[model samples]
Target: MSSTKDIDALIDLMAKLPGLGPRSARRAVLHLIRKRSLLLIPLADTLQAVAETARECLNCGNVGTTDICDICTSEKRANGELCVVEDVADLWAMERSGVFKGRYHVLGGTLSALDAVGPQELRIPRLLDRVPSEGITEVILALNATIDGQTTAHYIADNLEGQVRLTSLAQGVPIGGELDYLDDGTITAAMRARKSF
Candidate 1:
């Protein structure tokens, strides 16, 4: 007997998404309903399709509709370098930068003692296996600038020390950052990694 019951339920469900709160979700649902023919129906169909097919790539842990992602199967990406990221979102970020030409390896998460997450829980073992098999020459750690991220990076570095060259993204001031706004840790890293002009 409630005409707005299904709409309210839809708003409730949309509000559960990462960044959307109840207000945003209600606005979004209203927009979708207004554009039902052009957006809502197609969006529903696409969501259903993705829900049925989306899966993690077996080799690199990238999310895709196939067992392996397109990047893993691309011949042009066979440059002997592998960028290690903490999640699929990081992998996508690196790709968006368009600077890293080599492939990527996604560790499901960082190694956390409190969470009981270890190398095995991530893609560390798979990464080690891929080094020799895939002829990897260098590994670039592109993890976050967090304590757990550094710990995971160090663990990977220790394991792959002599087997391949190891590198990490520089942790310093952003390109447009002013020194006064930067933290002490960022300033120190920028000083330590200072290069010739």
Candidate 2:
């Protein structure tokens, strides 16, 4: 083992985090060491607190410091609109956007035949239960545009047909995006989802 074994191990662990490469992890570790009193110690304490208290919301599958997340418990969020997402990260992204006022249901993952992930593995059954139990009038399928995501959406739609108003997030060119810069798939989706203006 090297003299900096512990530091090397920290860098390796940090590199395992999403979007962080070996060089980035090394740089981050160095910065944290340089700013230990101001940043690293506080970050470590916060991480410990989160690790100790963070858990999944019982009703909606959102990760929070409580058994039920704030959104699920909020009366204002009882808007009869439930947005279905594939993961807690998707739920967080939607929250950050500050657009949707409805509650959310996290499916954990999509149905993947190769991965052997089915509806039971996800929160599909719980979602179905929530529609009637929570008096949900509409369900927005906010799954990703991948094949498995679409397949999961279709499955849920088929199951919930006639029970609630079904909708999905429109896919197309992003805001301020030029048509020339968009990929073929994005342009095609935009055309398909076009509306009369």
Question: lDDT by residue for model 2 over 1-197, one digit each (tens)?
Answer: 25298889999999999999999999999999999999999999999999999999999999999999999999999999999999999999999999999999999999999999989999999999999999999999999999999999999999999999999998988999999999999999999989999
The segments of candidate 1 whose C-alpha lies over 4 angstroms from its true place after superposition are: 1-5
| Candidate 1 local lDDT, 1-197, one digit each (tens) | 24388998999999999999999998899899999999999999999999999999999999999999999999999899999999999999899889999999999999999999989999999999999999999999999989999999999999999999999997777999999999999999999988898
lDDT, candidate 1, equals 0.95
Candidate 1: the clashing residue pairs are none
Q: List the residue pairs that clash in candidate 2.
A: none
- Cα-based TM-score, every candidate: 0.94, 0.93
